[model samples]
Target: MTKKNANTQALHALGQSLWVDNITRQMLDDGTLQRYIDELAITGLTSNPTIFEHAIGKSTAYDAQIAELSRAGKSGEALFFELAITDLRRAADLFKPIHAATEGVDGWASLEASPLLVDDAEGTIAAAAQLHRAAARDNIYIKIPGTAAGVKAIEASIFAGVPVNVTLLFSREQYLAAAEAYLRGIERRIAAGLDPKVESVASLFVSRWDVAVKDKLPKDRAKEKGNRLGIAIAQRCYRAYRELLAAPRWQKLAAAGAHPQRLLWASTGTKDPDAPDTLYVQALAAPDTVDTLPDKTLEAFADHGSVGAVMAPDGGDAEAVIAEHGALGIDDTALAAQLQQEGGDSFKKSWEALLKGIADKAERAGNAASKAGLA
Candidate 1:
């Protein structure tokens, strides 16, 4: 419906996987999510606090469910999970056959713990395990932030044999840290006489990098603005990902049947109207990497997304391009830190807003019940 001979046709033909980056209860129940899966070649899906917050606050879709949960004394974070897991589990079920068909290499959905717990190592791990348990499905990957605390949680959770999607990574260093945590966790599991083969992914967010450096990228060219920063960063990270997998440590891990957590490209929507909506989708195509794109981006890509040259595993010009920005007094590390902090803060804001909205709904529902009883 979006486009004939869609970009996904080329992407799937080339062996790269495309994943839809958003989900909703309506999407699941109405077969919209499944239709995307069938027509769009979408093998996976991802969700976060902001996504859940919006899906809950902006629609009557979740109201009846929320009302019932409130009656059972569920509120706040617990209430939110009840809603999200139910939706994700259904989506995961739809993807289950694809997952099995691919031998666990594809067809997965992600659920992140509270963004408020990003800096809380203990809290993140606890929430991750709790959500994983509550979901009770194998195709679901519990999402943990790739913050300092989250790195610790990633290692621990993986060791505990929980599949994880490491989210919020903004740079190569951050991605490497998350990878190392996975290594340590798998190594520990090996030492404990347990299977070290933990399924995981490092989600490298794109577009935000451009948003972080909108003015810094060489505006000397028309295409040099908007999403270029994120693409360059992702190109660079893909190079690192190639190198790390070829290293001896990872070779040993791979030899032991551990699935290397693939690097996923996230936040791929083009924010600038001047740029092609499918900018991120076209540039970051590589085998074994996942592109979790927003719906608009997906539609744009499906319409006109042509097969571009696959990203070089060697990371062509990424460091130098990033260095050009770094030379402009843009502290790359500081920017990563700032972005992460902002991301966490935004999640917290959404979480609180969702809680307040839920509270209001519960109050109104209570009043209606009271009126009905009195009548």
Candidate 2:
């Protein structure tokens, strides 16, 4: 499709990168991802335990690799990473042209560290380092959740020159915390005479906030009150992100070759069936940010989406929207905390299930090999 015919191309023209949040070996081997890059201007992708779980559990695409790895005595997390890293490396290679063309601003793929390390700061850092090294691709980002302890790991990881995608951020405050951690890492790198051009993105999750508050909102203005909270929060975070980019501190780092940490909008798929499929994707159109869409959402946008008025850096109506919710007894702080914790827990569960899926696949493969006298 030509750029004019594709709304995703229009989004790219507006300067926001379109990243597909879901990935599978089927997609990569079948050229689905390359087509996205060619036609829709998809410059990057992000991954988490849930996406990996679904990709592995639902497909035989990985069975042979799993069996081979199992035969080599790799199991559990080790086997999972081998599978993940192999897929991501291929994806990273496909995006490498864009990575070089953009000088590292776009064309990136991410692999999250084990969700089991959420509370383990030191372990998180070590795992991030190991994963980045093991992946051995500069275009890949090692994802770390933006939890309190994760913030510490983010700083250390960035200082060590590991490109990071800071994930699971919920609100403006959480986004700022991730930004702070990223900035400190950049600043330390500058001081230590290291390259301050480390790449990072603070991923503020949208859509989930709306899902969380929809049932709790007043019925009278529920249309106005529901589903819009996430956009408002995202706009507010965007305002903060713009402010940080303009700060003297950031400017100083910029002078020393540091790149601003771009704000990424995650969870852009609309959870409410009543809402438009492209709600978050269209609403979050802005320059210097990212909107990571699910495959269905990406296709919907490509088919029928239009760019809306870009978010006001001054946070147009975001404060009022949030304050109105606050007046309705929606505690933003409490809810953000709960969301972050729940997000971590959810990922941990997915990680466990992913391991179980791999184990099952390996066992079945072993059984089939023995039956065929091939073991």
For model 2, the stretches where C-alpha displacement exceeds 4 angstroms are 1-5
Quote each prediction's TM-score: 0.95, 0.98
Q: What would the per-residue lDDT of candidate 2 be over residues 223-258, giving only the tens digit for each residue?
A: 877888899999899999989889898898998888
Measure candidate 1: CA RMSD.
2.2
Runs with alpha carbons beyond 4 Å of true place in candidate 1: 1-6, 216-226
Q: What is the lDDT for 232 in model 2?
A: 90
Put down candidate 1 lDDT per residue, 1-375, tens digits, no spaces: 454346687787777778899998888878878878888899999998778878878888888888788888998878888889889989999999999998788999999888888889999888888888899988899999999999999999998888999998898999999999999999999889898767999999888877777766556743543455678889889999999999999999888888888999999899878888888888888988898988888988887778879999999878887786776666878888888888888878988887888888877777776888931
Poorest lDDT segment (10 consecutive residues) of candidate 1 = 217-226
For this target, which candidate reaches the highest lDDT against the unseen true structure?
Answer: 2
Each candidate's clash count:
0, 0
